[model samples]
Target: MVTLEQSQPKAGERAYAQLLDEIQSGALPAGTVLAEMEQAARLHVSRTPLREALRRLVADGLVVQQSPRVTVVAPIDAHDIRALFEMRRALEESAARIAAERGDAARFAALADELTAARLDGETGRDAYYDLISRFDVELDRAVANDYIASALRTVRAHLVRVRRMARDRPERLTASVAEHLLIARALAARDGDLAAHATHVHLHNALASILANLENEGSA
Candidate 1:
């Protein structure tokens, strides 16, 4: 996981980013208690800004305030994963259809080429692969040209970042995911709306299965 840097001018945003990074990276795992005084000191910010940061995280569903002073990271389980994917499937499938119809073919084709060339043989490659996916997401949102869908996708991506970390240790899943994304990228490049949507559906299905299996394995271990 990338280290989050502190921003002196915007303490609240910096705290929020740092905490969010820690939460997503499992450095601050689910159900970990976040005390105001402790976290404020730990994050090296004032209580007021730390409180603001915690409130933002609360709104993001990454943290929950149990009382005036007690806050904890939200739990991640089968139910949460399932619900998240259900919405992801709906939103992404629709986005794929619209993007295929209106998106930049050359851009998606370039992305497909990038995926095809991605090695994923080492940490640097893996980081590059994830960055490629981020670029693809940006292109999709741009192609769809819908503010509402983009906003909703941002929300889903936030949760997905945490879930994705759970499966990152699996090399097999990582390879398969790259292949799956290549297919979706190709379908989008071809401007085949149905094919693009179907490819996205399949990718999400495989992704969810991999994530759940990883979670179960960790639980058993």
Candidate 2:
């Protein structure tokens, strides 16, 4: 006896998903005020559900409560990006090392081939490239098999979407990233934990450098 209400997502959950997507996609850019009544209307939800959604976003650090009645999207700057990379480096490096030792070598070898042949020319190609990376991440997570580290990585990845959008225009960085990922995948395929870890570190270092440089360029522009 499953009722429609039970089968469908709750209003709060739906609102939260929509708001989270908008925030991450920059549709609701940082520092944009989230008025209760207005957002409820815009999202077509009641005030209570919208409040529930806002609370979740606050916990996620995607929004900030300015007062009892005011909330705004969180701002990301160079400092925030650096802190994010600091956490990412710690988590991803360890994950790569563990996965290299325990993961399916054949699967990683296939991923290495995919990375080697990836195309990132236009917007469509870029989307496909990102999809390939997502698949690689899925495999890495499955190989690592650590809930705690995976949970932390999920949080870091949420913010990373916004950060990635900032540097999406830099074709050079994208090209280098493909090479970096190829090295990591090859290391994992070879079951070389040290090499996987070191490759992950270098990849993160280069990625952070490129992102920061892009931010500086934008600021100067």
Candidate 3:
């Protein structure tokens, strides 16, 4: 038997997060039909909250409801994915610059906390490393706190997560990722917009190059 304790984020939010995670992890994949009844049964939740959650995803451009009938995952392609992550780099770098100017100590401290955990992971992790990276990325969004930029960042992050498991697993790649993120953090601390923005561009460029290289290699082999 299990005890029912009321929780934070309410039921809709909880379901939304779980479903979002599933989609991001590639379990749900783009273009998969998501029947409401089936999802409610699978998630062990009522249809109302699940529907609400789906609506949220739809608005976020992660899902789409068809005319008079079915709901399916949104179609995403390599070009779209590239554009989204590139937008993230641009938006987040600008935010980091602003966050530093605003003197948001708590935000920086929060990032430090997450980085400390990533450092403890010591390189690769099937689970912990990603968890750490996710936290750091979200906080980077928070540190900015502009509504428009934040909205775009959130959307981009969610979309990118769909491919992140593939992007992040390379050991050599992961090592460099940590170092670049560290540079961004250091720049933010010093309130250097130019440095923060430049470092972020370099970081994203490197990540894009790595992902492209791996993908190209996969195609050849």
Tell me, by lDDT, which candidate is best.
Answer: 2
Name the better of 2 and 3 by TM-score.
Answer: 2
User: In every candidate, how many clashes are there?
Assistant: 0, 0, 0
Best by TM-score: 2
State the local distance difference test value for candidate 1. 0.91
Q: What are the lDDT scores of the predictions, listed in order?
A: 0.91, 0.93, 0.74
Model 1 over residues 30-101: C-alpha lDDT tens digits? 999998899989999988789889988998899989888789999989999999999999999999999999
Q: How many backbone clashes does candidate 1 have?
A: 0
Our model 2 lands, by Cα RMSD against the true structure, at 1.9
Task: State the displacement of the C-alpha of residue 161, model 3, in Å, after optimal TM-score superposition.
Answer: 1.6
Query: Stretches of candidate 3 above 4 Å error?
Result: 1-9, 104-126, 138-142, 219-221
**Model 2 steric clash total:** 0
User: Candidate 3's residue-wise lDDT over 1-221, tens digit each?
Assistant: 43333432366788899889888878898899989899988887777778878999999888889854688988876677688777877787777677667645666556655554564244445366667667666666666767898777777778877756566657778777777877777677777778888888888888877877777777789
Better of 1 and 2 by lDDT: 2
